[model samples]
Every structure is written in C-alpha cells, then in structure tokens.
Target: MKAAVLFETGKPLQVVDGVQIPELLQGQVLVDVHYSGLCHSQLAEVRGHRGEDRWVPHLLGHEAVGTVSAVGAGVSKVATGDKVVLGWIKGEGQDVPGARYPLVKDGKEYLLNSGGVTTFSEQTIASENRLVKLPDGMPDKLAVLLGCALPTGMGLVFNEAKLLPDALESQGKSIAVFGLGGVGLSALIAAYTTQPKVLIAIDVEAHKLELAKKLGATHTIDLSTENWQEALQAICPGGVDYSFEAGGKAETIEMAFEAVRDAGGQCIFASHPKEGEMIRLEPHAFHRGKSIRGSWGGGSQPDRDIPLFVELYKAGKLPNLELLLSHEYSLDEINQALDDLEARKITRALIKIAGE
Candidate 1:
C-alpha cells in the first residue's frame, strides 16, 4: 500500500510506498480508500499547532469513502465488498482502539500511528464503528463530505443551533455564518433551507463570500474590508439570531459570539484554535441570555445523520455539495493540498485514492 507518513511535525509528509497493512484486530475493518477529504484538522496536526507530536510517523485523515475488503471478529456493521463512508465519529458497533502499522524504511522498521479512521493511504484499517454503509448510487466524491464537513457543518445548524424548520420560517429570524470555509458554507446551505429572513456570510476571501452568496447567503461581509462588522450590523440591525464560527481562529470565534443578539441568540464554533490560546468575550453578555459554546463534529451520529444528509442532498436541498470541492490531488501531492488549504486558495481539497 502507498501512504503519506508524517514522520515529524512542521515537515512535509513523506509518500512512502510498499507499506504493509497490519493484521486486522478484533472489531477492525480493512478498507480500500476511494476518496478522502483534506481538512484543516490535518493541517493543524502537521504544523505542530496541536503541540508535541507523540505519534510521529503516523497516518492522518478523518473523512473518506472506501469499500470494505475484510472485517475482523465481532464486526457486524459492514461486510466485505460493501461501500462505506469512513469518519472519526463513533457510531453503532464495537468501540476499539486505533491500528498501528509497521513499515520498513532504509532497512529500519518504524511504526505508524492511526486513529479509528484514516484515509491518507490506498488501503486503511478502520474500526468497525467508524464505517457507515453508503446508500446505493451515491457518488464516492460527494459521500466523502459526509464523513466530516457536511455532518459537522450541517450538524451545527440542525443539532447544536436546534434551528427547526418552523423556526427558520419565522419572520425576523436571522443567521450569521463566520468564515466561509467548507463547514461554514455547509452551515449556510443548511441554514438556508429554513428560509431565515437574514443570512450573513463573513470571510476575508472574496471568492468564498461570493460562493456563499450563490449558496444562499443573503448578505456577505469580507473581513478584510474595513467596517465589515458595521456592514453586518447594518443588515442584521440588532445582531443575528444565531452565529457560527468555522475559521479556527480566536478572533473569529470572538466575533461570532459578539454578533449574536443580546437575548435568545446562540453562537457555535466548531474550529479549535491553537493550544494555549483563549477566546475572551464580554462577561456581561451571558446575563442577557446569549450563549456561546463549541461543537463536537456538529454533534453528529454517523449512522443517523450521514444518511439524512445524503437524503437531503439527493432531494436537491443541498445543491452545493459538488461546489464545495475546489481541488483534487493524488496521495503523493498531499503536501500541495495542505499548502492550498493554508493559503485559503481552496474551500476543500479531495484526495483521490482510487477510481470511482
């Protein structure tokens, strides 16, 4: 198998071929990866943003679409030849530890660490619970989004924000999505389904904000421009009913929290800032009924929510799934993909591991 090995933090991943797949432990499933989504989380890990790398020379990737080749004992969630969407979120099935692969380089043996699910390899060993069987006829590229971006973004709106359909239809209900990345755009697409009176998209990139408008943002604010917050306030008047921060920066998170209305507005941020950094907000804001919190993969349950998101996409509710994919790269070009992500040159990069 070919895999991108992260041998050290703050260094490019080494594309190593002829890597041996470890034996499947109990509750593990071997999968032939088809397509994997490159997320900012991986970038953080590679750049040493999350602190010391105890798991050096490990595999990194959380979302992908693959076909099950084999399953270990006690694995009932999937079978051989079944197509599945692999994710980091735990689902129904046995909870098992991650797999460790052994590889030899320059006549020396080294071990590679991996979580329950990783997609940076041509072949991967995923825990049974990390795999979700895909609906027949779903495209592998689109299914890849369900593993992370779609679920986390849509989940933030549907689950954490708890924005019911009726609530969205209510007159004067407004939403502000901070950072027009994959998750932010996904939140905008999902929030638009509710038909909120106001949908504001904020970002430093004009292209992303433009895309957000096409995806149903009623208003767009470029953070790079002066008085962008003033522009947002002019449109939203008394702040928004809800706000979502996906930029993974402390400043953006603080802005999202402050952009909510004083009473009954909610702010949710799925991005994790660098370790040792903190977000400071007005202490008196909480007393006014405004709330701010973090999200865990948008509080998604892979078995239940992934299917629902697919159904919605199938029904034309999510028209921008393909638009979210700005670029695609092969396993060997993984470093370039990460560079593009860090440069904000792409919304989401899809790593093609195998044929459709």
Candidate 2:
C-alpha cells in the first residue's frame, strides 16, 4: 500500500512505494481507509516537532473514516464492511476514560492507542475496540471529523470542563473560545448547543473570527492588536464563566486563565505539545478557584461520545460540516496537504485513500 513517509526532522514528507501493510494482530482491525484527515499532530510529526518522530516508519493518519475489511480472530466490536470513524488515539480493548493505554514508551504512555488506527495509507490497521461505527447515512466527510476534531471540541466542554446542558440557563454565564480553526470551531459549535449567555471568540486572523461568528460565536476578538486583551475584557467584563484555548499554545492557555471569572470559571488546554514544552501558569490566580485542565482528544470515550455527536448532527441540531473544513487530496499528493496545513490553509485536510 502507499503511505506518506516522514524520513527526517524539519523536512517535507517523502512518498514511499509499497510500504508494507501491517497485520490484524490481537485486538486489531484492518481498514481500507476511505478518508484520513490532516491534523496538527501529523504536522507536528512531519516536522519532528512532537519529539515522537520515532514512529516515523508508521503511517501518518489520526482522524479517519473507513470500512472494516477484516478483524483479528478475537475482535467483536465491529464487523467487515461496517463503516467506522477512526479516532487519532486508536487502541485495542474497551478504552474507557481513565483507562491507561499500556503502550507507554520511554516513560510516557503513547496517548494514541497502539493497535488502533493510523489512516494515512490506502489501507490501514486499527484495534477494533478503538473504532466507532457511525449510524448509516452519516456522510463520510462528516464522519471523518468526529474521529478527532469533534471529540476534541465537545469533550473539552462536556467532559473536561463538565459543561452540563442544564447549567447554561441557570448559570446564564458567558464563554470564550480562543482559537478559530478546526478544534476551536468545534468548541464553538458545542457551546452553541448549550446556548451560553454570550460566546466570544479570539483569533489572530479576522477571517477566521468572521467564520467563528457564522459558527455561533456571538462576538469576535482580534488578537493581533495591542489592545486585544482590552477587547476581551470589554465583552467579558467580569471575566467569562468558561474559556477554552484551542490554539494549544502556552501563551493562549495562559490567556484562558486571565479571561475567566474568579472562582466560577475554568480554562482548558486542547492542543497537544510537540515536545516537552511547558506553559507558564499564574499560581496566585489558580488559588482563587479558577481551574486549568489539560485535555487529550477532548477527553473522549469513543463508544459514548462518537455516536452522540453523529446523532446530534443528523438531527441538524449540531453543526458538523460547518465545524469541519476538509480539502481532499490523493495519497500521492499528501505532501501538498501537509504543506497547506503548515501554512494554516486547511482547517481539517482529508486524504482520499481509496473509494471516493
């Protein structure tokens, strides 16, 4: 099968021919990848920025939607020909929240499941337990996103921050989403469902801020200006009740804390760090009852959250297509997709592995 192979650090991806197909081992499944997304993690890997360039020879897909071609003898969650959405962190066994993935290497547990899916190839292998079956008729384009971006957004609000639907009306609190790309927009859409009292979004680009408004942000803050912090202060005078930093930068994560109300709000970090980079925190501010939490893949438990997003989208109540921005390229053109992602060109780029 064909796959994008990252040969070295700070370099473009080199396409390799006849990359061997991995096996359907214990708790694993083989998928004929239909669509794979270009996510930040893959870009970080291509640049060797994530310090995980070691998984180089492996495939480069994290968010993908495809059909089951076969499964290991013991698999039971899904069957051949079934449609599934592959999360970036695919692994075997039931991956309940708080379950420790045993694929820990060099001290850190590989946040992504070992035997689960990596979708960059024409065909891929995933742990059956890690894949989520979409209800029939969910468009492949939409299903592809639920695997990564959707959960990262929804899980942050509903899981990590625990934004209960019932709280929006009673609390009548405002929220801020500090990034307007894929994950940030996902946060906006999820926040829309709860109908927060006010939804403010921050982004360096004015166009994305405009897009955020269409996606449900009641207001937009342009962070490029010197007084952008004042803009943030203006809308959220008492500070927002909840803040999410989708940009994944230490500076933005720090800003979330600065934007939240005292003792009543929480800020969440949704982006993954490339290396061991650390973000500074205000210890004194945190002591005032403001909480900061680091979230992984939006704290998703696939079985429960995946279907929920799909069902909600199907009802036309959730914004799926609007939240996801997909630009498809063939397996050979994977480099172009990565380049576009690097340039911040595509919100969520998808690769057409096979079967249009």
User: Judged by lDDT, which candidate is best?
Assistant: 1
Winning candidate number (TM-score)? 1
Candidate 2: where are CA atoms >4 Å away? 90-115, 165-171
Candidate 2 residue lDDT tens string, 191-308? 8777788999888877777778778789888888646568877777868989988885777888887888887678887876657778887788877888888887888888888878
- The local lDDT score (0 to 100) that residue 230 gets in candidate 2 is 85
My TM-score estimates for the predictions, one after another, are 0.98, 0.89
- Runs of candidate 1 exceeding 4 Å displacement: 165-172
Tell me model 2's lDDT, rounded to 2 decimals: 0.74
Judged by lDDT against the true structure, how good is candidate 1?
A: 0.90
What local lDDT score does residue 44 receive in model 1, on the 0 to 100 scale?
A: 95
lDDT of 1 by residue, 1-356 (tens): 99998999999999998788878999999999999999899999999999978988889999999999999998988999999999988899988888998898999998889888889999999988898999865699989998999889989998897775446344357999998778888888888887788999999999998899889889898889858668977998879999988988999999999999998889999998898889999999999989999999999999999888878877888876788999999998999999999999999999998977
Which pairs clash (backbone N, Cα, C closer than 3 Å) in model 2?
Answer: 50-274, 90-116, 116-126, 116-127
